[model samples]
Target: MELPYFITWSKQKAPTTLELSKNSPHAFHIVEGSTYRPHLKKIVDLSSMSYQASFGLRNKMITEAIKKQMSLFSIALPKHTFDLKKEVSLRLIEKAKRYSPQTGKLSKDYKCFYTLSGSEGIENALKMARQLTGKNIILARKKSYHGATMGALSVTGDWRNDEHLLPRQWTVRIPGPEEDPKGEGIERIILKHGSNKIAAFCLETITGGNGVYIPHPLYYKKIQSLANKYKIKIIMDEVVCAVYRTGPFFGIDHYPFLKPDFIVCAKAISGGFFPIGCVLVCNKLSKRYDDKILSCGLTHYAHPLGLSAIKATLDLTEQRSFQKHADEILMILTEFARDLSFRGFKVRHIGHLMAIEIQDKLTIESLIENGIYASIIRENLILAPHLNTPIRLLKSSLKTLNKLLSK
Candidate 1:
């Protein structure tokens, strides 16, 4: 058979059979035996940690989902279809409802909508906000990352998404929580734009991508007060921070007093088993679309297989043992981050998520040599490990990393 060729992210050419490993540096693709070192799939998905599920790997959960899906042989339909209620879609919806904090009496009401990825979920949130409020402008923070799609890219403040930034005039970028921790700039922007003209304020409860930057202690509360006073919907992008990644069901859960109108989530929701994104909205917002038609959907709006994967992943993460493991991992990550800081590395972290500013690309190369798959986001190294990653592996990797830094 003839060999296959592929184009790299940099537009370079290479053979598809190159070593079976080192092909997917971006985590967009997974190469088995190499990506999840020491312990095949176990390392990549250690419970509440990072979920970089690559294709071609079938763990027990994935196999079960596949089996269930094949057995049912259900037709693909829009998730809202009432006729499909008896199928896997209903189970997914019920599971989603259990995960949504907005459904409680004390909290703002919520409804769940499933998407194919984080970007789609974010786009849906923006669309919902604009349609419901009949406003065009959106408020996003500097250094924030919601997703890669046009609508999401337009609102993203980081440079990575700059190439995809189209002329979306409605998104207003404000300084991040680190710069305007008190959210004073948000109020100024709201006033300047005339609150009535603004559809929503989009924010990452804990900013990712640009480095895992935690928000100022009072940031959410201040933004919440501002949004409430002006009747602007608050869209909290918890895509990377939910599903126990940051010690909460939703990242916004960190701020109990604040009530964001929308929550966009993905990643860990399926425990890295499938590509899926979810939008959880307040009851008030859902009512707006109850009679009116929603203006967003994709071909795979809610794939049954994807929903099955989500249900299985949620079941795994919600187990008491998994929760305890996650708690322990958080502690370990906190101490690990502190040690790195003492070693003169600039570290930023919240819960199990962390980012270290390692400016040299060679250090990243060195990390790979040491068998630690570190995610390099711009100038920083994302050091988030799976919740079930062996503690010894982490320590060894850290030691190797520190040695590399010393040199």
Candidate 2:
């Protein structure tokens, strides 16, 4: 996909590498400027776009604030994502959206719901749950992150931050079947707490980004049955797994019979642009969601730019077969994971994902210096390469890792 615009700074120099690093989103050097800034006021600045600026840097407010407040001087923003000399976020967003055909996976009723940022969407979903059911306490599984927003962190499963890092809301964390709860049942927990205080239950479809840990058989269906029996609403958080990252658009597609009240999704939405996450409410929940201002609003709510990206993404998804993409990815990851497992590594995978706990392995910092920039998930490196990135790249990455490990 063509980027929205091009850069034309006279002092611009070519870059050495396409891969972005922390200091430099891309490798570049400066050409001698014809003139010099005599003072701080004369510095030129830029944003994502490569436009002329009067400030000497981009995102100076943040950089200067951090430098003075934190007492540290550093470059965190890359010229591409951050410190570019122009305001081209919209261009970056559009380019990102078009760069990948499949933005996200969705449930049956989606492709019609409004998308918002992750925290924004989660808060709205919870608000809807609160208003419709009139239940004060929201239950979520432990070790999950809805978002960083006020109301979102409330229902977030992780308690490490809730006590001081977030606001106090009527939130409860329910142990999943894996947590080894006291009883052999979720029904027991519901019966003990009673459904009157609990408005809704939210959990990821496959526990992605949280470990890609999937629940056992009849897990969701049982949850659905319990909610029905107790008159509580069920919401599935498919945000991480909603994109084509997992085998299906919506991981909950594996559990349609569960008939969740709401599905919150966003990752890979617009292929990482537009920050378009949505809570796809069901027919029943839709009727209950009403004319109030939604109790949650962001300046970028349904922003035209994001909506445009989403519409284009969805259109591309329909035109392109993301399922095929998922299938191919699954096959590749499965083979790679199986090979790792065959070598005595504790390899586990779901869909096109894999997380292995290989001990006495190579460290994170060394791998990068070796030119392998992988998302280090503890001892396991998270490898979800872009679909457009060639299979050779994946193979080369794995081969390089294996070589490094051999040393």
Candidate 3:
């Protein structure tokens, strides 16, 4: 059977043998909290996409929240002149404040701008940075994934940007700390191009998708200093690293000194059940648009259903048990990574997000054959299991991974 829709990032238009069985329950289906596939009877998903299972699949709390909101009001609440005050929206804002670095109990130092997806969040952040600074150039790190949109893609430093025929004249690429520890490369670019020409320094809190690369602590300090000196805004892309994926509420929280102008996030915010993205804007930048028209929005900017999901997810995070569970998962992953390293495999991780360096394709194939479902980026196999996965199951999965790696 031929599918009408084009699959993104796939060269093969025709479905493979695995795709053929997608509809069969015995082949590949996720029921309740577990995934089942033909090759791997009960697959353990360690992909970052599995973060949705933070509260487990088909969570009653999130479902009830969405259903309750849907019953009470119109789901599509577009921005209009006579906009009604939404309690869900207000609650979401209050809940989000806890995760923000610039927001405080009595401080009105930040505001949330909602979008439909992480890509939209990035697009809007880029737009606001350029609009606020009146500068065109955007400095982004190499091997980073922001989004698929043109503005976000322009700043992206991977093969995803290679397909575009148009030139990205305004975006500049900077090397990671591994190559330039003191941020000399970024300073050179800023000085050579003139700081006045640059709009923002956009980067992921921890480089995701292109391998989980965590830079040295001083690397963030150096860049923040540069941004301050150059008067350029800092945009921290926490699309994947936010929501306790990195132990901290926000990945940027790990670096207490750096405060970004825009913190863009999505994925796991609404428990991955609803599609929603947010740009948490510092009051310093947002205040400039108080009287002026911000001129950016979407049809479903802050849909009540998404807001409810956000509320439910945030409520779960606020639970004492949830925080303790996250801490436990972090310890488990840290030990798992250490064990892999002791066995001669290169491992990198922060909290539950991890990557194992593998040169042989068979290792990945073997893992998949044995019921481990993970994502591969170049030579790195990403192992980001759901934060709330059972400890027994997680350890069992790790044992299988260790056995396969030993081969």
Candidate number of the best lDDT: 3
Worst 10 residues of 2 by lDDT: 43-52
Q: Give the C-alpha miss distance for residue 134 in model 1, angstroms.
A: 1.2
Residue-level lDDT for 307 in candidate 2: 42
Worst 10 residues of 1 by lDDT: 40-49
Candidate No. with top TM-score: 3
Error of 1 at 380 (Å): 1.1
C-alpha local distance difference test of each model: 0.68, 0.54, 0.76
Q: Residue 118 of model 1: what lDDT? A: 83
Model 2 residue 331 distance off true place after TM-score fit, in angstroms: 1.0
User: On residues 71-143, what C-alpha lDDT tens digit does candidate 1 reach at each position?
Assistant: 8853476754533324444443343342334555454556777788888988999888888888989888778
TM, every model: 0.83, 0.68, 0.88
Off by over 4 Å in 1: 1-58, 79-105
In the predicted model 3, the residue pairs found to clash are none
Model 1: clashing residue pairs? 46-388, 109-283
If both were scored by lDDT, which would come out higher, candidate 1 or candidate 3?
Answer: 3
Candidates by TM-score, descending order? 3, 1, 2
Q: Residue 199 lDDT in model 3?
A: 94
For model 2 the TM-score comes to: 0.68
